[model samples]
Target chain A: MTTTASAPGRPAPVKPGRPLRIRRRMTPRRAGSIALKTLVIGFLLAITVLPLIWLLLGSLKTQTEWLNSPSWALPENFLNFENYQVAWVDGDIGRYILNSALATFPSLALIVVLGVAAGFALEVLVWKGRGGVLLLFLAGIMVPGQMILLPLFSAYFQTHLTGTIWPLILTYTATGLPLTVFMMATYFRAVPREIFEAAAIDGASIYRSFLSIAFPMVRNAVFTVALVQFFFIWNDLLIALTFTSVGDFQTIQVGLLNFTGQFGQVQYGPTFAAICINVVGILVLYLFLNQRVMRGLTAGSVKG
Target chain B: MNNVFGNKRAVLVFVGPALLIYTVIMLVPVLWSLGYTLFTGSVITGFEFSGFDNFAKLFSDPKVGEALLFTLKYAVILTVGQVLVGYALSLLYVFWLRKASSLVRTLVFFPIVLPTVAVSLLFQKMFEVAPQNGIVNEFINFFGLPSVDWFGSPDTAFLVLVIMDIWRSMGFYAVLLYAGLLDIPEEVMESARLDGAGGWTLIRRIVIPMSLPVLLSSIIFSINGTLKVFDSVLALTNGGPGSSTTPLTLLMFRTAFSYGDYGYGSTIALLLTVICLLVTVFIFRSSRRDLTKG
Candidate 1:
């Protein structure tokens, strides 16, 4: 692990003294590195975390206080659960949460099932002219999802799928399958081809090779692809807003926005509180699943 | 076509359901929407075949023109800012702040999972007027300057929307670039340094050139994402202050769903799809040049 200690235009390496590469230069380059690092990291932190912090602080403040105070400053009070209570019962996020779960969980489940089955078949199943099918799969990636909005809406209208969660789930599964299949197919392709050959020579059926051998080898990719698609379907708002306008089927994105106006008041505090909960919940889940998802993303990129 | 030889039958079997569903749900609508370019129609009443009237009408329509211009403006701002900022941040994480990279990466990518509507709502409240305390306005007032209407005005509305988008996507691009940076073999950087190539020379001459594939892909992703920009615009301004923030998707939605001008709306959708596909192909081709050079 060779490290670049210095670049051009900078010289006079300092005596190694204070421990841990602390021997430093006070030149503009050193200062710029420190300043640049500080500014970039601070800007990212402020942009990413501050909104949630502001949301939390706003949740604790009264409507008057929140509206009147500067956004970044904290509320004067502490641990006020009143906003949470109002947000849960009054704003109807309780029901919205259920709606979101209903829409997201099924889509996620379907995406995993379809993605894995397709990935396995593409990888392990012996087939001539599978290249064309793979090209069709890649074409899905090239298509921008919004292009389908009109026809999807029209399709739903004719199929009686409108105003129900089914349409959103179905659209989500379709849109999600492309990238999932793309990522997982390449991933499964990376599994040693000889292993599948050996399994076949042992009189193992194609289904058995996929079920008993290839599946376990690529389980990490499968899990990561599933979780990433889960987040995609979960964070979606356009499809939800477009396909289902019945309000009960609104996912959290549409749900949270509509809640701001629901109870005959602005209710900024509770909306902020609910947002705080949503932020923390998703962050925690992503953190737990981050490693697997990131590996899948990088794996896909390298293959590309 | 013996069963054993053509057992690719099962391959089709496995991939068929997903491809069929995706084609029906996602691809078919795009094709259907493209058909709208040939007709003048309402959503409820069937459309008559007018053949290119919708496209011609699109040129004459001021709102569609404005929305297209705005979408381009937004894409330019977002791609430039996100790429530059993301590259800088990736440099910081890779070369400067390796120890904090994991925590920073997780925190930054956290926003990628956030619902756009929620982000828009956060910004909306933060920029709301009449309170004198909207963070942006407050900052303006604290500087002893008159507070400008941020989203309430056309120029500022587009600017703020662009900023929100940059904030959302910069981290994403940064993480991707960082991964590319990691893929750069350590010996190359050391050798570059041994040759006294540092700072701008090292980055411009080496690091960036090496990461061109990732960079181009990020650019393509940003362009596609910006061209389809909707949820935040919908949640933030709803193309308000007189359609200043309206992008293609919003315009398409309005035409198709809001105004019941299905023909015109589908024309816009087809136009956007073609534009996006062209851009994607262009980026992919350019990146191929970079990859071969590698």
Candidate 2:
């Protein structure tokens, strides 16, 4: 964008200008620097990914091979994928994944819907208590999640939401509400109210205007919120542990945690295979939606 | 002009559902938890008025004090570690790797989405030294060094906890700080370079001062998050090595569930809540001053 500052007449044609001079002077030193940088980056990438790769490879190896050999040892049976089967059947990660999906998807949808509406209300519509309501949510964003656990547990049992996905869903949505509202509100505020006003003058109701104008304007934010909330719910362990305690009802996290205790000592292959089962979904989502995930994760910091 | 947008009912219509759910699930629970601090028993054991009894216990209990001390230590160490590693990674991103680091950044951030339980289990297996050969031990053996019991003692276990945490979330802070670094306009950087500010000096005098707000925010975020940490530690060591790794949250959780002492558990939770709130406010206030100065 700023290349316009150094246009054709500025300095390019005279005495091989500053940029060209720097390039000419940079061959040897730049090569060394580039090599150094690549090394550092490679080291970092290894730290980030080598353990995960080892986890995958280790899972493919049998328990005896995994323990007897060093961590870096390659699996003897690349064709044998029995560990995943064991993790799914014996560890019951399949059930847990199903339970987690049941908990995450519906709540994520509800949060998006509720959050978008609240954002429109506070950020677009002229309401008397907008600041008060916004303040409520801003405060909600800061509320330490664990602090609400005991009372939520109390309510969970009373309402019969415990031992099922309902309590986890409710907890996720509530905990996710503040950020959802805040992010969506920021998106809504950026939207031009004049469009909504024009729609109102055209005999369209405010609800209709929102559906037609403001909602479309804030679709990116809605998607961002959905992705972020899904990540939170799926990654959550505290609420899942407290609320979904039944063996059949546990989410992937709780299931994986319990399964670890049972198998971590001796059954390294299946244990890690179960861990991979849980992570693969998130990893795949991350690969496909890396940019959106980056933007959504960083969005919180910007708004805050 | 009589318009549908002019009505207050629209406000309620838009905001009501979210507020209702948030209030029922979050607001009410917070208040209920506060009230629970004054009671002395559980659902089955019945309740009794225990005025200041839980608070009194919180102070006298040596375990509570020990847990508090550990929580503070953990918060300070982990927060600092995260900030340093993140800052370095951000510098690497902007100054060196540029677009080449995109794949690396994605890989780094991948762990942030993995369940804490899974990562902790991974680390637990990796660091295991006794009874069987885990990865870390395997690595040490490959180098001709004797195996060290990583989690057999309090100090090593706590160190592993700290290292695992930094490994898991360092990417988040790095990416966050990198975004902040990118926000420094290219023009300012070029001018700084032109003015003979090179490398560390430029970063020290220019970037640090410029990105103070984001830096402070990241610090506060890490501190508050670490202060209330439960699941990661629970999954990692379950506050093991003879309660050496036990944080305040774990202590509170066990008190409520394992011991069925709801009142005392709630009291510990309230302490954690107050600490987190105080950190948030303090850092927020401090950042406001710094931000306004810019």
Top candidate, metric TM-score: 2
**lDDT minimum window of 10 residues, candidate 1 chain A:** A295-304
Model 1: per-residue Cα lDDT over A121-197, one tens digit each: 76666676567766777777767666777777777777887888888889889888878887878888788877877
* Residue range B92-170, candidate 2, lDDT tens digits: 8888788888888887877887788889988988888756677788778879999888888899999899889999988
lDDT of each: 0.78, 0.85
Please give me the DockQ of candidate 1 compared with the native complex: 0.54
Computed on C-alphas against the true complex, the DockQ of each candidate is: 0.54, 0.69
What TM-score goes with each of the models? Answer: 0.90, 0.94
| Candidate whose lDDT is highest | 2
* CAPRI docking class of candidate 2: medium
Q: Which pairs clash inside model 1?
A: none
What's the TM-score of chain B for every model shown? Answer: 0.91, 0.95
